[model samples]
Target: MKELAHLNKYFFKYKFYLFWGIVFTLISNLFGIVPAQVVRHALEMVKANIALYFLFENSSLQVSSYKIITFSIAVFGVLILAMAILKGIFLFAVRQTLIVMSRHIEYDLKNEIYAHYQTLPLSFYKKNSTGDLMARISEDVSKVRMYIGPSLMYLINMVILVFLVLSYMFSVNARLTWFVLIPMPILSLSIFLVSSIINKKSEKIQKSLSNLSTFVQEAFSGIRIIKSFAKEEKFVETFTKESENYRKESLSLTKVDALFSPAISFLIGLSTVICVYVGGQEIIAGKITAGNITEFIMYVFMLTWPLTALGWTSGQIQRAAASQKRINEFLKIRTDIISSENKNQDLQGKISFQNVSFTYPDTGIKALKNISFDIKEGESIAIIGSTGSGKSTIANLLFRMYDADEGKILFDDTDIKALNISNFRNQLAYVPQDVFLFSETIRNNIKFGINGVADSEIYESAKKAEIYNNIMDFEEGFDTKIGERGITLSGGQKQRISIARAIIRNPKILVLDDCLSAVDTNTENAILNNLREIMKDKTTFLISHRVSNARLADKIIVLDDGKIVEQGTHEELLATAGMYRDLYEKQSYSETVPS
Candidate 1:
């Protein structure tokens, strides 16, 4: 209940529907009890008419008495039928209000969670699996919905029916009513014990489901790798193991849930037996009639379904609480990267990293150590480093994907943190070392960076990336749909398409982090030539290992083991015997002796 308290606002938001639902439930139950009373009256009337018929036996009054009895019974039948019809109508209204409110709340909740996911820092994603996130939003929300809709509706209906039925039963004979209620305390104790076990098992089942979902998602996402390595059997075996575990957890829950109906039915049956026995004794003692016994039995049976549903509703509440607790865990998370609300500032592309230092939060490894560099407006600087030399970290810092743990980064002589994060990012284009494209057409992928882009702009960007000819070679040209993450395209094609996406943005600053690694030297040179013209009077940061790419930059910064070892023009770096020269000589020799 404490965990589910988060939904109070939503309940208040749709209070109108909730109010009507409760009113309708009360009216339906009121009508529902009328049929039981009608049955009791009919039985009493038959008993009285039987005596009258016997007294008028073999006389003219006997026929009149029979006719009166027939008419009276027919009238009672119509009254009972009317009560049933009215009850059904009110029941329909109850569902229309409460069920609809539950649906509305579900919609608002899902959108809220998804929007929150978008605002969370990248580190949050690193800490959580995609499947667990999906489970919380999809599976957990659905469980909560069950609590809000069917479980809640039945609970209200049961409570109202019990009050109405019990009040009438006690009015008729308090002693009989007390005898009928003897099994209630035992039933309650059973429910409390079973409910605790259900709560614990429900949480375990949900966790198992999350693990199963995570495994399936990873398997599908990496299906290509599995097939290539011929590990299909291994994957199938692993999937089976996960599935078996999920099944076992579910069965365990079902075993506990199985106790609910039988226990409720047995207690309700005991109440009915008590009613019959006590009513007979009352009749013999001249305190009640046979019709009273019949009515009491009807009341006990009337409560049977609600008592059974009580068990189910309790289980639902426990499950919803478990799921809501999971949801609250994510909703309570606060993102570390809070964006400033200043969107009016403009970028001039003069960037400086003043003694910037950073460490990867997840791994606790220092990726950058007292790194300092500067880039003037309209200048191109290439950062050359070996693997793990922290080249990509520089690009991440520039984009503000992460903030430096120490020192300051400035853009146009202003602290980067002070600028509007959205506006600052909108002015920059970044092509990461690992490219990702959606399952969209090539044209749409090129136009992804900005909305309302013209087809001519898409074609121009594609041409600049040297991918226009390859796109035209396809049957659908730019309209060809790339599969998930551009799996249908070659590695070079995917990289070129990603490059076109960045190029189409026409940003003031461009960060290409080893984007041309897959393309041939000829294509690379062609794209670089186009960039030379486009990047005129714009800041460009080319992060790569190749000296061929670095030589064209105005300045080259060589990094070794997370520290800047050298910085100079290409000719000056080649003149000196440093890490940059050693890398250049090695790459040159490797290129000459290639297979």
Candidate 2:
């Protein structure tokens, strides 16, 4: 209910459009009831004609009676055409207003969700499935639109139309109105039961659809791995299973949804049969005129459609309500990275940690335990360890991707939590182990986030990363479009482009997470040399396992099982004859024995 109510803000903004829409609906209905009134008048006129003919069988003026009836019908026909036209015009206005309201809600919800997504820490994405997130943004939002534009409007119309139509009938004949409304309770009870079933089935259907999306996304993303292992048949079998499940659930939901309208309508139809039976008897018994019967029956039948709408509108509300619940769950996730209210402050390269500790939200064990370190401006450092030894965790902390569970990280002794996260991260540039490039030109990828950088700056950054020559060799040069994640480029080439992007930012701090593992030793050496020339003033944290990569850093640190075991210069560490020296010997020994 809270999530659905969030849309009320948008409705308030566009209330004037809604007001006019309702005004026109009233106008349309006013004209609509005109036909029902004319129907009653027609019955009166026909009865009068019958009496005149029966009583004055030989009257010469009977020709005038025929003329009077014909003229009355022609006038009714013109009035009906006019009513229909006005009704159509008002219907269009109502539909357009609903569309505008739906679109406004979509815009506001999309922006809110997207903005929330941006604020979430990296751990959130790691925990949540990408397929589920995409479903929220697309499928969930569309459900909200269905609720706002049609379901909600239908509800409003249902209330107004029922009240007004019932009031009119009651005024005409209280006894007859009581007979017509006999099925009203049965109709309400039926709709209530169906609506409960619809909510449960709709929730199941959405969950099934979410799984289907997950299967499709994962299957395509890992298609290469599946093919390499010859698992096409397995994937096909899996897809069939998921698709069949989705199909069954969707069919069940449709069946449940489809049963509602007819059930409501059946009860309403029962009332119609009674009206016809009772009304006919009354007229034949001379208790009421035929014109009165005609008016009452027309109004009684009019209640059927609105009653029927109540069922489907309930289902739509349930689906949208489920979607709204999902959306609110997403919005309610607290941003792990705390940001400052003032966001315009600049950052320098100096960073320090004091008695810092962190454990993932759901885990008892810590990723980084009681770790404390500091790096001055223009200092170069390397962090090396086995996989999952918390080497990258240090990089995560430096950028405040995840705040430390205990103590504080600081920028030159100022608490990192006190500074604006966006401004703080803007000061640092990181190139991760997995390189992600947009499906765009090499130049554009390098120039992302900032605009109007000169060609020379792009060339310089590419040259520093040792990718300039390869980019120039392409037929389209730097302008060539790189496929998604730079699929067109080799692994080594992709790493270099990622490097170029970081270097181009010319940030205060540079962090690389095993960025050069793909490139050959010769290219690695050249790239390192270029980085030395370009990164003189920039503070750097280099994460790697290879001794050659770590040797370039001014200071070296070794982590083992989330604890810092040793820290010193390369020569100092080698002289100490600790883990770094032993690891170096093992790597060097392997090089000589390799094929």
The TM-score between candidate 2 and the true structure equals 0.96
Instruction: Show model 1 residue runs off by greater than 4 Å.
Output: 58-60, 340-343
Worst 10 residues of 2 by lDDT: 336-345
Q: In candidate 1, how many Å is residue 134 off? A: 0.9
Error of 1 at 307 (Å): 1.4
lDDT of 2 by residue, 406-502 (tens): 9788786688878877777777899998889999999999877877799999999999999999999999999999876687789999999999999
Winner by lDDT: 1
Pairs that collide in candidate 2 are none
- Model 1, C-alpha of 334: deviation from truth (Å): 0.7
Colliding pairs, model 1:
none
